[model samples]
Every structure is written in structure tokens, then in C-alpha cells.
Target: MTFNLLLSLSIALTLVAAAPGPGVIMTVTRTLQFGLTAGLLVVAGIVAMDLVVLMATLAGLNLLTLANQPGLLTLLMVIASLVLIVLGIQSWRRPIILRLDEGHASVSHFMAGIAVSLTNPVLFYLAFLPVFIDLDALTLHDQIVLLALISGVLTLVLGAYALLAAKLKTWLFEQHPERQLWLNRISATVLFILAITLIHSTIS
Candidate 1:
């Protein structure tokens, strides 16, 4: 709704996307196995899934807002904070078990991307974002802007991973477990920060 909100969203998404996860690993792996093209396909698949998740979240939030229930905003904010906090803690605690034994039986990298996105445990994290943005007040134009922003962020983040994978074929990142742990810590911090920011926004 505001430039500041849009800018914050962009920055937040960039950090989130950069955080090491199944999606990023898949992108890098595909890039190494196939090429940048395969990685791009995976990014596209992830973005498609992102669209689905955002739409579903918006619709569900709209339903709640339309009901004119009292204290709904506060309740949603609490739910959002709790969800983010849980995700942050889980991210910090989750163990990295790289499954590189893929058979590559998929018909196309594009489809594989969709499959990974669909199975992404972090997918529904998108649902908790309504606390940060006023989903019920978004206009059609705002929706388009949001979509474009998200698409751009996804492309930029995943595309950077693809390019990096292409350039550093010898460095697949799996070789360094420490780096993954750092990524997890950074992601967890960001999630916690987001939860705090949401609560602050609602309260003040």
C-alpha cells in the first residue's frame, strides 16, 4: 500500500530467498546437473507455487476481515507471530540431510521445480504474511504490484543462485556444512525479526 511497505517486503523476501533451504539447494543442484536453464525452470516453478500460496492466503484473510469479527486483527497478528517464531526455531533446530541420490526421472526440470515447490515445507510460511501487509485493503493494482514484486524477487534470488552455480561448478556448497548452519541462523534471525516487527506494527 505504501512505498515503505513495498520496499520492506522486497528486502525481506530477498533475505528469505537467499536463506539456504530445499528450494535453493534444488536450484543449485539442478543448475549443476543440467544448466542455468534447469535452474531457471525451477525458479519459475517455485514462483508459480508462490502465487498459489499468496492467493490462498489473501482469500482466507479476506474472509476473516469480511466477517467483521472483533479483535480479529490482533488475533491474526498473534497467529502470525507464533507461526513465524515456530518456523524460526525449527529452522535453527532442523538438521541438514542432503539427499543427492536423485534419479532425475522427471520429464522436465520445469515440472520438477513445481514438484519441489509443492513439497516445500516452508511453502505455507507465506500464509502468515497478512500481519505485515493489509491484505483486505489491497486494490487490483496493488495486487498486480505485489505479484510483480514477488516474481522479481524470486527471479533475482534464484537466478543469482543459478548463475553462481554455473560459474562455480566446483563449489556446490554442500561441501561446507558450516555455511549451511550460518544460513539457517541468519534465516532464523530474520524470521524472529519479522515476528517482532509485525507485533510492533499492530501495537504501535
Candidate 2:
């Protein structure tokens, strides 16, 4: 990848990653509930999903193809919506209890993060957009390098956000747990709305 190409990809990835979506909400909630370690694990899962989506898009399974397979896309989106709704409701009901003694690090928590990340369609869409935009111009070696660079940038951006959320957990919970609940609810509502919009768009 040329410098210009890399710079463009980095800028695009940064903007996409910075956008507040289901992944962001999940990372924040996991960080608050389980700590930074868990949030990072979720970040890993998200990155993995991005890789899969990007690869698929590069292989010509573009958004248009997905749109054409409305039955599959609709099913996936509905499943994802249900997962987001359940997660949001659970986060609202349960207060985050920090276990300082045991330390907040576990494979299970990391896996949970991955599961949450995999369930969100918005992440797939974001990953697909960049692949659609950049894949055709690069040679095979450059494509591999570009994919690695993009993935690395995304991982770093997401990890930073997860770490920031973990760092802010104390202040966030202390100030108002109810506020976090409200935020989770709002995030969940947005997720559902997006899911509906995607379905409608696909069908139309």
C-alpha cells in the first residue's frame, strides 16, 4: 500500500470506528461491568468479525449481494436486534459490581465480548464499505498488506475506546448508574431502529 492509500484507509477506518454504534455500547457496558480486560476481549471479537466481513466483500459478496438475499439478511438482522435488546435490558437491570480482589480478567469475558461484537450487523456494514471502496485498486500483495493495515488500525482504535471506557467506569458508576441505564436504553433503541431500517432498505 502506498502512503496516500494507507493514509486514506486510516482516516476512513478512524471515522468509522469512532462512530457510536452497537459495538461501542457493548465495549462500554462490558468495561463498566467486567472491566477493561473484558472490553478488550470484545474488541478482539469485533475485529475478527470485521476481518470476516472485509474478506467476504473482497471476494465479491458485497452489500448488493447481501441485499439480494433479503431472507438471510433479514433473519440475521432480527437475531442481532434481539441480542442487542436483551443485552441492553440486562445492562439496565444489573448494577456493575467491580471485583477488585479477583481482578477483571477472564477468557470467558473476552469471549463474551467477541460474541457481542459478532451479533451486530452495523459493524459488518462499516467493514464492508471500506473493502468496497479500496479492494479493486490494489495488487494481491498490496491487498493483503492493506487488509492488515486496516485491521490493525481498527483494532487499535477499538482497543483505545475500550480502555477509555474501563478507565471511566468508576466515575461513570459513581456519578449515576441510572444515567448509564438510560444510555444503554438509548443505544438499544438506536440499534433496533437501524435494524428496521436495514430490513426496509433491503426489501425495498
Candidate 3:
């Protein structure tokens, strides 16, 4: 049962990671602007926050279930949708400027990553985590293992996105400056689509 639960959770996390969200956008932005190193730093910050949230959820902040808090999930969906739309618009309007300087901004990149992830309620739904398995049925050891596996899977998924963006930075953007702007527009469009989807889900 424990193994089954782990597998289920891993699949769910993979799907979630693949979905366009703040963390993915942050990773793409950092990679496009700074390079692979900065992108990795942003991913580290995101994963750190995700672990913190998971720990909180395991510690009984199972707010994701919305069992106790009426309308909380809907509220989160609405807020997240609005935020995504704003982010998308902002990205669409921002000029594509590449800053590969290595002197500073690493800390800011990391913190921005964390802040983006934490603010995205769509990513770490407190109710979503507990839906895969019965937390009460699991022993403390089981819970720890589940969380650890989740963290690992999350890192791999987000890391893949970072690497892909970094590769594109050199392969496409370096050769053609306009490519970055197009990429930014594409990312922004994805964000808008995600926001629309969330809103529809909330209403439906």
C-alpha cells in the first residue's frame, strides 16, 4: 500500500510539474535572462518552499482538502487565476533583455523563485497532497518517505524544465535575438491559458 501510494503521488506530482505555473515560468525566465546557473538557483528556491509546504501539510495543515474551510479552494483558485493572468500580461509587456552578468543577483533570483512558488496556490494545494493516500493510515516513517519521494520527483521535473530552457537560450536565442521575445510571448500565452483553465475549473 505504501509503495502504491508513493507511485500514485509521484505520477500526480509529475503532471503538476508539467503544468505551466509560477515556478516553471520563473525557471524559464531565469534561464533566459541569466543562464543555467541562475535557473538552477531559482529551482532550488522553489523546491525548498515546496518541501516546506509539504511538511506543513503533513504536520496537519491539510487545508487542501477544504474539508473544514468552506470555499477556500475556490478562493485560492480565483486568486491564483488572477495572479497568473497578471503575470502573463506583465511578461507579455516586458522587453526581452538578456543579462548574463555573474557578479550579483543570485540571491535575488533565489528569493524570487521561492516567492513565486509560495504565492502560487495552484501548485501546492494543501488538499491535493492528501488525496492520493490516507495520511492517518501511514506511520511517521511512511509519511517521511512519501514526502522525500515527492521532493525528489519535483526536483527532477523542474530541473528538466530549467535545463531545456537553458539549452534553448544558447541554441535559439543566441543565434537570433528575436527568438527570446517570441519565447517570452509563448510562455505568457501558456500562463494565460492556465489561468483560464483554473477559472473554468472553479466555476464549473
Candidate 4:
């Protein structure tokens, strides 16, 4: 949990949060339908689940660290790097279309947010975390700070998305497909860079 690691995670998470996805689309669609508060609820739900996923990942990472098997850890890191690279390529090749499904009337917007998060999940962010977080050196204070970073960054970034979903819905998603394409590329670029950085760190 070095400052550089936190900073890199913050920047990378910001970009990932801002990228187009089911979560973003839900925020936009719900905001357009129910209003800003509704959108924030959605963000809240997503953030809640994100923290859950992070905690679970941290638990598994702790077990890996405690095993004291550097070779196994290194192998996993290599695998994770390859996965990130493949994800980058797939995202770069994918196209985004703006279509809003009429959400279930019985489900609350907050619940819908949780469902979207669960459905698409945080595999991308999960891959990004172990690359930067050194479990061997992680103190309790560092763990607290790390959790704070994840929650705070997500809240600020996704909250901003919810705040702007109304304005951006038409201009960004609906009208200019190119703009969305660039966003997708940005996410892809981040993924590729993370993969390379992880490989370098593991070997070095």
C-alpha cells in the first residue's frame, strides 16, 4: 500500500468506473426515469457490492500470501496478467449500443443497481487489485487505507456518473457513438498497461 500504488489504483479505478457498462447504463436510464436521487441509490448499491467483492478477494489473497509459496503466487500473477491482456483486447473489439431496458417495476432502483453489479461483476477490478496490493507487506493500517481508497474512489467516481447521467445520457451514449468508442478504448488501454505493469513487477 505505497502512495504510488494507491495513486495508480485511484487513477485506474476512476477510468474503469467511468467507462461504459451495464452499471453506467443503468445509472443513466434510471436517472432519466426517476431522477438524481434514484441514480445515487444505484451508485450506492453498486459501491456496497464492490466493497463485498473486494473483501472477498482480499481474504483469498491473504491465504495465498500466508502459504509462502512465491512460485505459486508468481504463476497466478502471470495468469492474471494474461487475463487482463485478453480482457483489454476483447473490450477494444467490442461495440457499445445505447438501448435502455425498461427495468422491472417491482424492483427498487437500488436493488436493480445491486443486480447489475452482481450480473456483470468486478472481475476487471479484481485483476487490478492484487497487481498493486502487496499482501506480504500489508499492515492493518494499510488495509484500512486500502479499503478507504476503494470505497472513496468508487463513490466519488460513480457518484459523479450518477450526477451527470442525465446530461450525458443523450450527448455521450445516444448521439455520438465515437465518443463512447473512445471511452471503451481508454478502458482497454488501462487494462493493457496494468497487465504489462503487473508482469514487470512480478519479474522484477
TM-score against truth, every candidate: 0.58, 0.71, 0.67, 0.57
| Residue runs of model 3 more than 4 Å from their true location after superposition | 62-105, 122-125, 178-204
Tens digits of per-residue lDDT, candidate 4, 47-128, equal: 7867766676666555334224477546655665675676568658867645633223323556656645644423445567
Candidate 1: global Cα-lDDT? 0.65
Q: Indicate the TM-score of model 1.
A: 0.58
Ordering by lDDT: 3, 1, 4, 2
Candidate 3, residues 1-204, lDDT tens digits: the string is 566767777888899888887678778876775677878888887788778767766677655455234586567556666766776786688685554333244675576566566456633545586577776676788877877887788789889998898777776765577776777787678667767776765665
Measured by lDDT, the strongest candidate is 3
Query: Candidate 4's error at 123, in angstroms?
Result: 4.0
The prediction achieving the highest TM-score against the true structure is 2
Candidates 1 and 4 compared by TM-score, better number: 1
User: Which 10-residue span in candidate 3 carries the lowest summed lDDT?
Assistant: 96-105
| Candidate 2 lDDT over residue span 1-204, tens digit each | 668767876788788788887567767666766677778877887787667666766666656566566566556555654554555455556553433322456665454444455445533554555563555665778768767976798788878888888778767766566565665555456545544554454455
lDDT at 175, model 3: 53
Runs with alpha carbons beyond 4 Å of true place in candidate 1: 61-107, 122-126, 170-204
